[model samples]
Target: MKKKVSLGFKLPAGMKPPEAFELVSSEGADDPAAYLAHLEDSQVEGIVTGMGRRFDVSLISKLPARIKIIATASVGFDHIDVKAAAARGIAVTNTPDVLTDATADMTMLLILNVSRRMREYLELMKEGWGKSLGFEGMLGFDPAGKYLGIVGMGRIGQAVAARARAFGINIAYHNRHRLPPEKEGDAHYFSSLEEMLPHCKILSLNAPATAETKELLNKRTIALLPKGAIVVNVARGDLINEEDLIEALANGHLGGAGLDVFKNEPHFNRRLAEFPNVFLTPHAASATVETRTGIAKRAFENVARVLSGEAPRDLVQAP
Candidate 1:
């Protein structure tokens, strides 16, 4: 008899269903709880995709002992506690590499959108003010002469820096370790966040989600920024204190923000949306069809590897 694994995913209906496994999906669920109860009752290995905090180990109570692997369609594993999964002797895996460039592209897109007031112009056109190309309209800032501080100098952050150079941005970054000169020589590294924050006219965050980075941009750090500084976050939502960010933008202490992720996803930060100076995206940084499909396929392949007892190349736990 073939092993039956339960898959939990919230994928596009357009996404092709996996033919290789027996699946349990969100498409048919009245709620995720009903699906989890079903999985808990069954005695078999589990396969999951698009699993975002739906089946955290504690939530499972007496989790299936037969379940050996859990894989998620998302690249970030903050939603699933790897430490908890590892303690259970369950292998947890995440998708990476495929979404880096696409995510970086959205980061740059947000930066351009907020800095240049691109959204305002589109709104202007919709309001029938587009006919005249006059100098009376919004005066946007050019990034070419600006200072850009990137919070994380990882793969995705490096990609954003490369493009900023074409706009003549002098990039400075803060990270745990300095990127080697060969990897990111154009960016001058700062070991401390304080040293980097004051110099930035634009700050883009690309750090992975982790305990150390949660609310990394709280009120104290936000105070360190120069007046009229623009902020961009496409990495993780929890890194910013949405309340503090809204206050900073509202009081005019900060210039504007371009956010692709939020503290509460699929839920609105009502204050931020009302600001003309802010640009918000629906966490679609890696939402391109090509990127999403690639993430799914890679995640599925990793699930196969983890279940087979081979070391998953991108395993998040060893923690």
Candidate 2:
């Protein structure tokens, strides 16, 4: 008998399924129903997938009894219900650390795009080069000595703050607990978003998406930020109110925004996409080949560890 693994992978929007799986994927295949029939197959033991909301929390309970591990190929695992998997004695793992640097780099890129109006400036280029009437062509602010408010002080946030330090940006953060001054060093800590927002020129929302964090940047919270302040989000899409953000930028309440992720992905917010002050991406914060390969390797390694009856090195739950 041949050993087979059943994986519930969410295919990339236009990508043909990878050659990694043996059971064959429904993506681009003639019969999509063939993939769903795995529930009745007895040989399938493992599952793997992309980052998405499809496999809802309740679905984990209905998984085949033979399924022992669920691995997600993303640095963020907020989509998976960790506690549910923990209760079933099924381990959950996520790809992390590998994307820390790439994501941090995107943060800097956003900062430049939002502060300096990169998209609008490019329009000037297309209209014909060197046609300047005044000294003020496309004014994007410099990062030096500006105050940056980081919502989540995790690994990626820390990496962004580190780079900001080199550019002489004054860094502050709002976290559940404060890191010691020696560890935080030059970066200051604010107990609340209110206290932090007023002083920041660039406010970054880097927290994972959750029930409490959804639509966190609504009108009320946006009002707390200083006038003409830039904003950035490379985290989960649900963290901000897209409609509210657009209005802010259009009304001149905010300077601009840079986003790598959005609330409704693939089907992006048409309004935000049209705004010249808004720089948008299709969630490529960790899109580098080296980073993606590492993510895949970590996800695979975690599954192998669970199958071997040894705890995964990056286990999010106990066995």
Off by over 4 Å in 2: 1-3, 6-35, 38-42
> How well does each candidate superpose onto the true structure, as a TM-score?
0.91, 0.88
Query: How would you encode candidate 2's per-residue C-alpha lDDT over 46-102 as one tens digit per residue?
Result: 666676545555677777678787788887777678888788877888887888899
Per-residue alpha-carbon lDDT of model 1 for 58-161, expressed as tens digits? Answer: 64445667777777777777777667778888877888788888988898898889889988887888899837767865888888888899998887888888
Identify the candidate with maximal lDDT: 1
> Candidate 1 lDDT (Cα, whole model)?
0.80
Going through the candidates in the order shown, the clash numbers are: 1, 1
